[model samples]
Target: MEKKELQYIHSFEEYVNEFINALIAYSPKLISAIFILIIGLYGIRLINRMVKKIMLKNEFDPTLSRFLASSLLWALRLLLFITVISRLGIESSSFVAILGAAGLAVGLSLQGSLSNFAGGVLIILFKPFRVGDSIEAQGVAGTVNEIQIFTTKLLTSNNQTIFIPNGILSNGIIINYSLQGVRRADLVFSLSYDTNIKTAKDIVMKVMTNHPKVLKNPLPAVSVKNLTDTSIVLAIQPWAKNADFSSMSSDILEQCKDAFDKAGVSIQPYTIEASK
Candidate 1:
């Protein structure tokens, strides 16, 4: 029994020596890996800051710049991790394969998200609309507040905030109202059938020309669009800056009404009847 106990003690001591030697042999590699990790993290931060500065200097869009910076940082950190693993005598090819498999699984599971990300990339590259541009698309109209990786934010004219998925927006037709800097205000009015078409047109043209916000170079147009049974449909088209479109149109409407009344032009009236 004593001999057996001594043999067991001897085996335990040998195991301990082996473990210690192995630890001693790998200690330098472990320390180097840790050092590389620390320095690599610091370097990533420095690179991120430098990239931000360069983007800002180049006048890159803020949303695109932020997205690019974060993506680059993560990619660099991933490369650093692979380097550290390789330095620790681990096969990096297997690690990369494992990462690729995981990425594929995640991508498959989040296909919609990936599509939105791709759509955002396309939008940033193509620039159909920019921040602050008034746009109508996807059955919604609003000013573009922000363009994000997966979604876009819009501030509606009625003071509502809307988040539209980038995938849908990119695929749809975008109507950028502010892109041309100027827009046409189309106004229609009904005059009594007895009213002289030429006189009514002259009144509308004068009002449009006298308006301070209306553009004269395009030459405001007033024409008889239709002859209804009870009235003559007159169409007034005026050009104005996009920013002043609403107010200019409203002013023209009010001014035309006042001028029509003063000029003795009869306006068509609407009457409703109750069913018997």
Candidate 2:
């Protein structure tokens, strides 16, 4: 019994000594890993700031700049974490392999989400449209409210909010109404054949020219478009700023109607013919 107790004490002492030696050997590496992590984090922040400044200087879109900075910062932090693990004597190859496997699994599960993210990246880079621009795409017409990673928010003219997936938006044809500062308002007005065409055209042109919103450079135009059985179709085209297009169109229509009524001009009412 005495010999057995001595052997146990001797084993315990050796184990303790080995643990202490290992701890001492690893302590400096642990400190170095921590120090590197701190410095790496600081460096990442500095790089992010610098990148943002450069992007701003280059007139990059604000949304794209923010997204790029965040992505870069996270990637750098991930690399720093892997480096710290390696410094602590962890096998980096297995760790990286595990990360790869996990990423693959996640990507497989969220294929649609990944596609949307890629689409968002493409949109930010290409700049098909910008926030506050009026756009028509995917069968919806609205002003771009926000551009997100997976979806875009649109505020429709009828005050409806739509969330369209970036994947579909990026692939579809986008009609940006606000890209051009000015837009042409094409309106067709019908007058009875008995009314003088020259007088009607003069009246329409005068109304358009007098309007505050209409642009004088292009010169508003009114011309006879077509002759029908009961009426003459006049095509009235006026140019106005995109922002004022809707209101200007409405105002012109109202003013034209009032002017024609006061001037004793008759507007023809359409009567659909029954199918023969």
Summarize candidate 1's per-residue lDDT along 1-276 as a digit string, tens digits: 699999999999999999999999999999999999999999999999999999999999887798899889999999999999998999999999999999999999999999899999988888898899999998889999999999999999889999999998899899999999988877888889879888988998899989999998787898987887877888888998988888888888889989999999987755211110
On residues 1-276, what C-alpha lDDT tens digit does candidate 2 reach at each position? Answer: 699999999999999999999999999999999999999989998999999999999998888888888899889989999999999999999999999999999999999999999999998899999999988999889999999999999999889999999998899899998898788887878899889998998899899989999999788898987898878888888888988889888888889989999999998756211110
Off by over 4 Å in 1: 1-25, 269-276
TM-score of 1: 0.84
Query: Which candidate should be chosen as best, given lDDT against the real structure?
Result: 2
Model 2 stretches with alpha carbons more than 4 Å out: 1-26, 225-231, 268-276
The local distance difference test score of model 2 is: 0.89
TM-score of each: 0.84, 0.82
- lDDT of each candidate versus the true structure: 0.89, 0.89
Shift in Å, residue 216, candidate 1: 2.1
